[model samples]
Target: MSVTTTSRMRHLLTYAAFVAPAVLFFTMVILVPFMRAILFSFQDWNGISSDIRWAGWSNYTKMMSDTGFLKSFSFTIKYVLATTILLNVVGLLLALVLNLALKTRDFLRTAFFLPYVIGPVIIGFIWQFIITRLFSEVGKATGWVLFQKNWLSLPDYAFWSLIIVTIWHSAGYFMVIYLAALQGVPKDMLEAAEMDGAGRLKRFWHVVLPLIRPAMTINLFLAISSGFKGFDLNFALTKGGPFGTTESLAYHIYLDAFTKNLFTYASAKAVLFFLVLASITLVQVAVMKRREVEM
Candidate 1:
């Protein structure tokens, strides 16, 4: 073979050697489990028996009449909406503040992002104690009704408390993304807008927002997906308690499969949940992409 051809072959082989492991790992870890789950969704298995009966579409149809499933899914929708908005708003606001030429910007950035580094289950347990114990003591001392009530025992306050913890846990992650996007906004454009007598808010609305649309797009997708698929916090914090009002779809799936021994039914619900999530994410990304280009 010619020297050029031989050199090209070695370079291709080198690249393949580096990429092959990641491709293999993903296929084994993610793709295999997903395919298996889809198959299991249609089978009547107690998750332990040797015989796995094919139940066809019964699993899918079960969701329509499952009150617990419906309730959990509904609550999840509310949670997703609350978190998506709060995380993006809070995250972007933090990013903007930290972006300012403050001497403590680095420390603030690290401090804000610190919570996200901890495992979410740990965060849930930690918050659970604070809300139940610390808040109760403070409430008794100050005679504040908000803290005195059983925050985790009441449906109205339980989900809100969950939202608070989720936003606090995840806002920093979104902030780092927004901060990167904000930093990429052209300094000259911002200065020129200011020179033209545009006020700060107008400058941000007109100039900064449009430039950071890409980041906003990504952040929205992250927040929505995370909120929808949230499990750890819900599992650890409330355990879907207070009349099952705070149970997320994910937690419901676990409860059905492991706790209730409804593995087959849970598998079906999992499949449907997968479809709904995939659809929402796809539609959202498409719409947001169009909006980003327009802005």
Candidate 2:
């Protein structure tokens, strides 16, 4: 081969060497399972058996008749909305507060980020005990109406409790993302705006926020996805308790497949979930990207 041809061949081999591992792993880990799920969604299999019957659209059709599944889906939506809003707001606020050069900024950042490092299931158990025991004692001592009830046992309070724990668990990680973005905001631009008689609040609203829009976009997407498929925390905290009022879609699906032996039904739900979440996230990201471009 000519020198140029030899160099091109070498480059092709180098690129393949770098990309081959990831492609193989993705196929083995993601693609294979996803394809299997699609197959499973079309069949009636009790998660284990020699008998696997083709059920066509029965699983999907059954979901329409399944009120609990429908309710669990609606519950998931409420959770997504609550966590998406609270996580973004609280995370952004924490990011703004900790970006300041306070004497305790470093310590505060570490403290804030610590919760995100802890596993959600463990956090759920801790909060469950705290609410059931510690808060009850405090309520008895202080006569505080808020802490008097067993919050986890009540539907309304259980819903709010889930939101609070999710926000507390995830807000710090998103805060770190926002903090990094905030640090990237052009200080000179803010100073120039200040020179133009723009107040601090005005500068923040117009300049700083616009610059950090990318991070906001990312945090919103993460919060939505995390909330939609919420399982571990909901499992550990409520176990869909009281009257199944706090049952997340994930837990509901888990019950259907593992508890009720409706593997095909649960697989169908998972497929629908993947589709709906993907569509919503895509639309949200697109809209936010457009807004970011405008700003």
Candidate 3:
């Protein structure tokens, strides 16, 4: 081979050396499993046994009539919406307050964000103990009706409990995103707004909000996806109790696959979930990106 040919071959080898591991892992871990899932969704297999029957569209069709799946779908939608709204709102509020020049702002930020660093399962179990045991004790001592009621035992309260815990667990992370965006806002713009006689709310609404739209986009995406995929908290805290009112889509899918041994049906549901999540997040990013201001 000539010198140019040898150099080109060497560069190709170098590039392959860098890229081959990622491609190989992707094929093995993600692509293979995804293809297998698609195949499984079309067959009647209980995750075992070689007697796989071709299910065709039956699993997909069964979802329409499966009331448990439908109820879980509804609950998941509500949970996503509630957590998305509240997490963003609470996170923004916390970011705003912590952005101030308070002496304890650093400590407060760390304190608030500390929970997010903990595993979701651990957080859920801790909160479960607080709600189940500590709350009862406090209620008995203080005679407070709020703590007296079993929050996890009531359907409505159980639903809100998931929301509350999700927000508590995740809001700090969102706050960090917002805080970073807040810090990146141009000081002169805020001063200009104030000089124009804009009040604090006006300055924030007109100036800061638009400038931080990118952060909003990211936070919204994370919140929506996290809320949709929520399972750890449901598992550790409620276990889809209170008449199964708190069952998230992920939890329901888990039960169908593991508990009921409906492997093919669960695969079908998982496929639908992936599509829905992809569509919603794409639309959200598209719309939010349009609103995002440059510079």
Candidate 1, 1-295: lDDT as tens digits: 9999999999999999999999999999999988888998899999988988999998888788889999999999999999999999999999999999999999999999999999999999999999999999999999999889989999989999999999999999999999999999999999999999999999999999999999999999999899989999998899998999999999999999998888888878888899999999999999999998777
For all candidates in order, the CA lDDT equals 0.94, 0.93, 0.93
Residues 63-107 of candidate 3 have per-residue lDDT tens digits of 999999999999999999999999999999999999999999999
Location of the lowest summed lDDT over 10 successive residues in candidate 2: 58-67
Regions more than 4 Å wrong, model 2: none
- Residue range with the least summed lDDT across 10 consecutive positions in model 3: 286-295
Task: Return the clash pairs for model 2, or none.
Answer: none
Write candidate 2's Cα lDDT for 1-295 as tens digits.
8999999999999999999999999999999988898899999999988899999999899889889988899899999998999999999999999999899999999999999999999999999999999999999999999999999999999999999999888899999999999999989999999999999899999999999999989999999989988999999999998699999998998998899999888899999989999999999999999999898
